[model samples]
Target: MSKAAFTSDSLESTFLAYTRVLSQYREYWDFLPFAQFDSGWSEPKVAHAMAQLTETDIEHFERDATALYQQMVVLFPEVKMLPVPELRTQTRPEVPFWLHTGIGGRKLTQIQAFVATLPTHATHSPQHENVLEWCAGKGYLGRFLAFTRNSCVTSVEIEARLCEQGLAAAQKFSLSQRFLRANVLSESATIPFSMNDRAVALHACGGLHTTLMTESVAHAIQAVHIAPCCYHLHGEGQYRPMSHVGRANDLGLSREALKFSVQGMVTGGDRIARLRQQELSWRLSYDSWRQVHTKDHLYRPLPSAPKSLFQGDFATFAQWAAQQHGLTIADTEQWQPYLAQGHKLSVQVRRIELIRHVFRRVLETWLVLDRALYLHEAGYKVQVELFCDYQVTPRNMMIHAHYLS
Candidate 1:
């Protein structure tokens, strides 16, 4: 294998360096509900812009403000960016006509994207007798691999309904792709990987993928390709580091901080942005009202509400939110300041996020680098890269590990 683009030492150094910076500003970004504006954390221009910001500026803030992201630029001049599409290392096998017909446009795109990454992914290791698919929703990739590579595929999925569907599809094609309905997270879920096996997980969420890696090492899976998604999911309230180096690091990321790693969005359009802004602002406002009544300064995360809740004015949303938590909503005039403070806080929060945004890829890369390091420790040569463009999928990064004897 060619030299890895970033070695374990380099990835950890970048991670530890940025982790140091993030910890330095942890108090500013964490506890968003009560993150007071501190002039010390923000530079003069940043502080000034934050003060000038109002709800109206949400639409056109970037036009008037050029230096908002300047601090990030200065701090991380050589930061490794993400979302670069993976190289076409292996020429794609001709897809059967029927393979392209049944799927919807989005699913079709995802399948094709997964196909494009496989050739490059396949090049990293020796061929195996079978493929072990993890979190194999509908077994799309397994079906394709079994067809193209002529290897039996053992697909593992949590949902029986999806397993039935995927099994039916594999039967239709007469392909040797079989599904096992078992939660990859459960100890009872046996993923039968052997020396002759190569494992692939398209986009396993959080610890489900971690479980796969841990099990792959335990079972001595010869080759593996994994694309990880949803860094915040099923981490037992915080990230359980996958590698010894990661475990030893002083930077301890809470679930909230881990959520911040994936907060950078590419496909979310203006409408989604506005809705998010409104939800956050209203939550801050609700916190203010709740604080005044209960005298509790601690942050309470709100449950996900229907989109319709955010479709109305801040007051309407605030009233609904107040009722949800049994807070007695005072009359309109008294609640205005809290609502306004919420909007103001949203601006400051976004501004503070500007600094954190610089470290988004760094943190994400660190997580995956940890995975790669785990594989390395397990005696596999690992390589990490973007498997698809962010437009095809924001969850584009893939960690490929192959047992090299």
Candidate 2:
């Protein structure tokens, strides 16, 4: 079958773009990446550069945030011009009211989007005998498949509670679904697959989704639908590319750099945005304070704190950080200039990251392409596309691979 136009140049160009910015701002982004300025003002040179950021520059940075984002879109245009595929229109099955009893709104919407898109992807593949939901959380996606699609469903999840919950829900609905408790990372987690098995996974983080792709080939499963997320969660420090093409192009992504790929938050509401900014400001301030007394400009990642800390003034937050680190900062005023520097650095970080955002999706596609190309190399026909709008989830790219006789 002739596939719609999807090309490697997009990922290649984006990866090149990502490499350029990463190289250009290696020190700046590595230390002050993500607008959090992970490194405190310990390096005199780095601090010196930030200290020179005038108030006018900060105001300009703030004003141009939206414009910079628009410029990013123009620079790296989306190339996944996917042809509209056929979707299941038979009926929307009754979503058991109990199924959503404890699920939050965001999770529910994600589930909805996953279920809505699954059928369209599944239809494009050769008909298979069963559905295997990888890293299935309460088997929500598999449950929808079992009830709507005429297939036996097997849900695999590590959590016993989720297994129990999914099993109970399946029985209540009288659907053909079963839950398997297995640590996906273990050797024993391989699902017994036949060519008749079709698998699906939604937002499987890092190596979890990659494992599914490899297992599908190892077992010769007929089809797979996977949307990967949380690239930073991989056990390895650097991303090991999959396909030969992906491997050939040395767009090495470190764990810290991987965080930038999924850091775009254009869809969040104003309040969520403010809270995020506030959180980063306090954390940056803490870094600034630590740099002065401890003489360590290293970026120290703090543990989870009460929301009250973020609610408090910078002075109180600095004291909390000092106390937490067993350092007695007798005079917080001395660190005031450092805190001011941190804020200035945040503005600079934001502006630098706007350029990084241009390459975010394209780099993601390159990674996704590596996974797809790996599947293709393993003898499965693969298709990759944006499964939903960014509003639904920024990590919305889906990879569908099918094996035909």
Candidate 3:
């Protein structure tokens, strides 16, 4: 199809075509099931491991944690701790007034540090400024750019609430920023053109980032900076290989791996304990539900709603659901007191932690490679580095790019 005729449907069709092409070139995409990781470990073995690893066994726990960390390193040798330079020395007072505000201060500090890493260049002319902020929820970064750089910022978002919220925030902050409510996936939502303009997206999701990359190149955006997240949520309904090496090889990237990438990008090591508990809960719930319902063995598909029903106490939820769905309640009266006491809360946290580790490694690899390839394709000088160590925050990696031409 001609580029102009490539509407949303056409774009989606093209994407599917590309997926087929990619499949033809690669073996794993065709042979392996997408939900292979969901099979999980044997329930008995998992239960045994959980029972053996009690909170009182601190020494054993420590050893296990250390071993897990080592395993993580082995699984993702490319994952590096981001270097955290002292912000006090690096932050400049005269940078911008907004830089002193709440989260803005931290963001500004990070932005300045990121800028320092990029090849220096004079800001593009301000006369015809048009900046696009991809996945700009509440226009935080866009507002900063508009106020400090004196540019007209267009914050594109999928949710109407976020667009409204962003516009309100811009008004409250007294910044010249506008929020455009549109799905990035929609072909009608094309990037506006201005010869000297720049595009910026922070933590844009997988397919959304790819859209930005395509938009930037198609529109010939003069400058762009992006930090991507949610690598598993790509256009083909799966993670697309970002590097030639990944494309050629079949490395098992689980759904948990995708979730970990999101966790690493957003949460830091501080939430490790909580994450572990979460993972345990998920495992229990999944296994318990499977045991109770013999026919429907598969985990429910990703719900088409705002929140997950699996967020609360699983046993309690299961009991409630049993009545709602007209299913016989399994007799486990001995476990009722423990369920009532919410002892499984800790397990929930552990489950999240374990799953996050799996997802983080897979997602991080995709994210790093995506940025690297996007920059390379755009003919811009780019460097990827850890913005902060995984201990401080998992989302510490920064993709710094500068237009050399």
Candidate 4:
């Protein structure tokens, strides 16, 4: 297979067909026991009971999702006005600058330690010992691999600053590695590189991993180890199904379906982090609001902002958010009273965790299927298994593949 032979449309169509088939597995949607309610809630049971009592029950449940769409539109009418911060900015300093900062140093060291434990394999062919790191951010993994395996590495990155930082690190360590700054999205820019080398990508987000798969197969790269993350960031702005398996059989996948598929990748651990951050933010906001108002009132929902903004100081953030929402804060002393409201935060966290637990299996299934399809397309013998059994690392599933051709 060559770059000239790989068609993006063909890959997109194949993925759309796979998702349509996957949607039909009613068993996949089975309801788990809800501890709060004495009786459990089951979708099939509810559908069956409704059908027994009314002639239109089954039809209503099976109806096209038109009503659901209308309800969503009404609830979020000003969707076009929603503020989404641009993630890629030329003005924003590259991650390497932060790496030298205390917090960044700790993060980089932690990542290096983690990568050290990941398993490695012999060069695909004993004669060709080079390795290619796809979307290699700061080339951390590439440096580690080169040091551990005593092999030369060529790391590809789109950001020039990242490439420079990686090169600096390589020089510091005196490692046999080189960094190339180029957009992986352009096949011509990336594919002509040394084709016989092994390839690896650890948690390469979205389309970056997909390009690796396409390129690896086209070049007949000997071996590849990839762990994909952020499935929703493709050129299509949604998950284009990669396999023709399951409910993806008949339906043409929509952008919304792709979004749902991406959301489905969030694991129990990820949800806990989200829940904790949400609870902490809410607690801080409520405290700030209560200081200005003496009345004991129920808390209202907080307005939404990009996830990155949530990392800042809560009190300062509240003040900034208040101006945006057209609200005024009069008193700052009653903050203690709102901080005393512990029950709400506890209940919300518990509820969110329970919901996450119920959805865990489905998310894992989607992750496995996506990796399996990528390996299958690459003509590899693939095995999917739990990389770790501990609940703390449930997302430790690994897709191991060996070349079949």
Writing each residue's lDDT as its tens digit, candidate 3 over 108-189 gives 5555444443333334554746678888877777776676566788888889998997887788877778887888878534
C-alpha displacement of 392 in model 1, angstroms?
A: 1.4
TM-score-wise, the better of 1 and 3 is: 1
Relative to the true structure, candidate 2 has a C-alpha RMSD (angstroms) of 6.5
Identify the candidate with maximal TM-score.
Answer: 1
Cα lDDT tens digits for candidate 1, 1-405: 122455434555544655565565454445443354443554565456455655455344332222333434444334433222234443445787897556776655666666665544332235545888888988988888777677688998989999999999999999889999887777434657673368888878887888888888888788888888878895576677778877887466778767876765322577887787778788888887788778887656677788888897767777777788877676744767888887777677666655555555557767777788788888887767776555566677787787766
lDDT by residue (tens digit), candidate 4, 254-336: 44334443343223464555655455545445544653454544444455665555565556555655665466665453444
Local error of candidate 4 at residue 363 (angstroms): 1.7
- Which runs in model 2 stand beyond 4 Å of their true positions? 1-68, 74-128, 187-190, 266-272, 282-305, 323-327, 331-339
TM for every model, in the order presented, reads 0.80, 0.74, 0.58, 0.53
lDDT of each: 0.68, 0.65, 0.51, 0.50
- Write one digit per residue (lDDT tens) for candidate 2, span 264-341: 634356565566567776777777777766788677867677877777687777778777788776762665677677
Number of clashes in model 3?
Answer: 29
C-alpha-based local distance difference test score of model 4: 0.50
> What TM-score, to 2 decimals, does candidate 4 have?
0.53
